[model samples]
Target: MNPYFCVMPFFGAELSSNSNKITPCCLLKNNSNIDEIRQKMLDHQQPVECSVCWNLEQKNIKSDRQYKNEAFDFYLNKDIKSIEEDCKKGLYSEQIIKIYTSNLCNSTCVTCDSYSSSAWSSLKGIKEKKSIISISALAQLDYSNIKMLSFVGGEPLYEKINFDILNYLIKAGNTNCFISIVTNGSVKLNPDQLNILKKFQNLNICLSIDGIGKRFEYIRYPLKWDLLLKNIELFKSLNINLSVSYTISNLNLLYYSETIDWFNKQNLPYNHNIVKYPLHFSINSLPKEFKSLLSIEAKHLLRKHLPQDDAQFVFFVKELGLQDNLKNISIKDYMPEMYDLIQKNI
Candidate 1:
């Protein structure tokens, strides 16, 4: 068994920003690197293209590589040895599909951009809505061997292509297949959409929550805190699997402890993903003095992730100030403590 073996390269497909391109995983920067990653894993060499997972693993955090390998191990009833052999011989079947339908989303999140959110695109004067994935291209794949289908979008719930795929799966009698959607918790599922969702027995709804109350509103602008809670209750009523996808960023670092406490009190299970794009939003962008005021636990966790260069931190301050001005919202109002610390230092 190769320690670097991951099931993603052999058994999973991810839609890239381009409609026709499919890569091994979303974290893989270059689609062309997929084959190289597979070859490296088979040779027991760590692929540099998989730095996201490697960084997490180095930080003593479980990476997507580990989680996917574990999940597929159970699904296929195969150990690492058999999986490694299958890959070595170029024998494998796709069992997982992750699609990013389009950038048609409702909220312009602080950590998000025009590529993933239509709201952000509109704000930036980008017209011509387009799909990152081709629905017809997916139809060509064999659905029989599929064990998991995950969708992320501008907002999957609001994307018509998501329903198009779901309808296709339903027609193929693949309702028993595990389905997961990462949503922003802003859109309510209409009766028809709710009915379609109810057909799936294994549905995992992962809500993207960054902060609680006004902080959440500030980060996910044009979204009401009350609406999010109401929608959460609505999903919970379905009795399906629910989890939180909490994103960690410089803007939300100070609120982490309290926000996590909120999740714990609600008995919501969560997984945190460190933001890397829009480098200013990265936790590493926080000034040294601001970080010194964080709790010991937060400080320790921050140590796991690499710190950004000073230039990026300077960029972050400038970007936040610009956005806050444009949005007519003040970070000082939503995140007073961190704002004060930053003001004192920078």
Candidate 2:
């Protein structure tokens, strides 16, 4: 058995308008490199395409590769030669599917871009359109045999296509398949939507929460903290598996200790990943002096995910100033401590 084997390259796929190539996962770049990735795994060699997982593993953090392999273990337990043959002969079907239907989100999060959120496009006056998935493209997939279906979006809860895909699975009598949705915990699910979701045997709702209270509202932008709390209670009432996905960036890393304590008090299942793109938002951009005051855990995280350049701090400050002006909001009002820290450093 290949100890480094991953099932995603051959048995999983991600559908999004962000790329034209067949992408096996959202963390991986959109490209037709699956064959290469698969062969590399077969040879017990790590492919650069799977660096996200390797990086996380190096930091002793659980990666998507580990989680996916475990989740799809039932399907991958067959003979290795048989699995290879099946894939080559087109007998193996896609059992894990991740779909990002459109960029039709309500809130414009600081870390997000116009490509992922319609609200960001509107705020920036970019005139971008929602990139909805085509019916023909969705029709190509065999949903009946699927073991897992994941949806993320402009906010999966707001995307009409997300529910449409759920309805498709329900109608196909594939309600037993695992369903995962990453939402912003902003939208309230309607009775009809709630009923549809209740029919699934395994449903995991992972909220994208970067910070808590006013800080959350500040980073997520225009999304009220009260609304998020109300929605969290609403999802809790559903008796489904709920979890939180926390992203640590320059905006929220300073508040990591408190936010994590809050998650612990709420007894919420949670996982965190550091922001690496838009290098300015990375924790590494923070001055050493500011970072010196961070919690031991936060400092450890910073070390794990080092910054490409500390100079990017200037860009983050500039961008925040521009956004504060446009939104008619002040970071000093929402995040006084962080504002004070930045002020002293710069």
Best by lDDT: 2
Please give each candidate's TM-score: 0.91, 0.92
**TM-score computed on alpha carbons, candidate 1:** 0.91
| Error at 98, model 1, angstroms | 0.6
Model 1 bad stretches (over 4 Å):
17-19, 77-81, 303-308
Q: Each candidate: how many clashes?
A: 0, 0
lDDT of 2 by residue, 148-192 (tens): 888888888988778889999988899989999998889977898
**Which sections of candidate 2 miss by over 4 Å?**
30-32, 74-91, 304-308
Give all candidates' CA lDDT scores. Answer: 0.81, 0.82
